[model samples]
Target: MKRLFLVLALLSAGIGFYSCTPEPHFDNVPVITFESISKNTKLDGFGNKTDSLVIAVKFQDGDGDLGVSSTLKEDSLLYKTTYNYQVRTFRQVKGAPVEISQTISNSGNFPRLRDDNKIGPIEGTLSRAILIYPGTVPKNDTLSFKIKIMDRARNVSNEISTTQVVVNQ
Candidate 1:
C-alpha cells in the first residue's frame, strides 16, 4: 500500500511540473528601415567638395508602444531593447575595383514603454561621415553604401545596399 501511495505522489508532482508554462522570451529582434538619403548638391555643382551624405533610419514594430528604461523609482513590464547601426561607403575608382571602404558605427538603448515615456517614430540618425573620399571626382562618379541594424539580443537585420549614385563635379 505504501509503495502504491508513493507512486501516486510522484505522478502528481510530475503532472504539476509539466503543467507550468514558462514566460515567453521578450527579447525581440527589431526591424530596420532606411527612410532617405540626401547629398549636398550645391557642393557637387561647383568644384567644391561634397561634404557628406545624410542617412536616416526608422525602426518599427511595437503594437503602438515606445520603449523606455525603468529605474528604482519607476518600474514597468514591457519589451525593452537597444539598437545598433552600421554604415559603410565605397568609392568606385577608375582603375581600382570597388573596395569595402569607409565604415561608421553607433548604438542606442530604449527601455520598455511606460506611461510617461515620450519619443517619436522609434527612429534614430547618424551623420559623421562627411568626406568619403579625400579627393574630388573630376567626372560624375558613382559610390555604393550599405546599412545594417541590430537589436539588443545581438540579432542583426539583413544588410541593405543602395543604388549607385554618380557625383558630378
Candidate 2:
C-alpha cells in the first residue's frame, strides 16, 4: 500500500509539472518607466575616481521574453544614455516634478543581461547599478540619463529618463 501511494504521488507531481505551458506575457512590447535613482560610492572600488549610480526601472511584460539569448546576439534588453545635469532643467507642476527635454552630444549603451537567458512572465521594478568611471562621467558631477529595454522579439519598451542624479564624492 505504501509503495503504491508513493508511486501515485510521484506520477501526479510529474503530470502537474508537465501540464503547465509557457504563454505570452504581453500582447505587444514590454512597458518600462523610470522609478528612482541613487548614488553610492562604495561600489566604485571604494575609490575617489569613480562611484556607482543606481537606477531603478519599473517594467511589465505579458510574454516575458524581454531579453536576448546568448546563441542569437551579444546585447541584452537594457540600454542607456548620459547627459550633463546642467543641460536640462526641471519644473514644478502642481507640486509634481516634471522633466525637461535635453539634447545630449555624447551617448552610449548600458546593456544588462539575464543569468538564464530565458525569462517567464514578469512584472516588477528592476534596478541596475552602473559604475560611473572617470571617463564615463566625471566624479562629483551631476547628470541625467535615459534607459530602455527590448524583448527578444525586438519589441522595445518606453524610454525613461532621470532628470538629474548626482554622483557621490
Best by lDDT: 2
Highest TM-score: which candidate? 2
In model 2, pairs of residues that clash are 24-62, 24-63, 25-62, 25-63, 26-62, 26-63
Compute the lDDT for candidate 2: 0.58
Per-residue lDDT for 1-169 in model 2, tens only?
9999999999999999999986645555778877988877664445445666677778887666655444443343342222111112333445555544434332333233345554566667767666656654434456666677766666767777775766645
- Candidate 1 local lDDT, 1-169, one digit each (tens): 9999999999999999999976432324556556666676544555566546566655553332434334412322222223445556666777443645433322334345335444223433433233444354435667666767554335665666655666654
- CA lDDT, every model vs. true structure: 0.51, 0.58
- CA lDDT for candidate 1: 0.51
Model 2 quality (TM-score) = 0.53
Q: Which 10 successive residues of model 1 have the least lDDT summed?
A: 72-81
Backbone clashes in model 1: 2
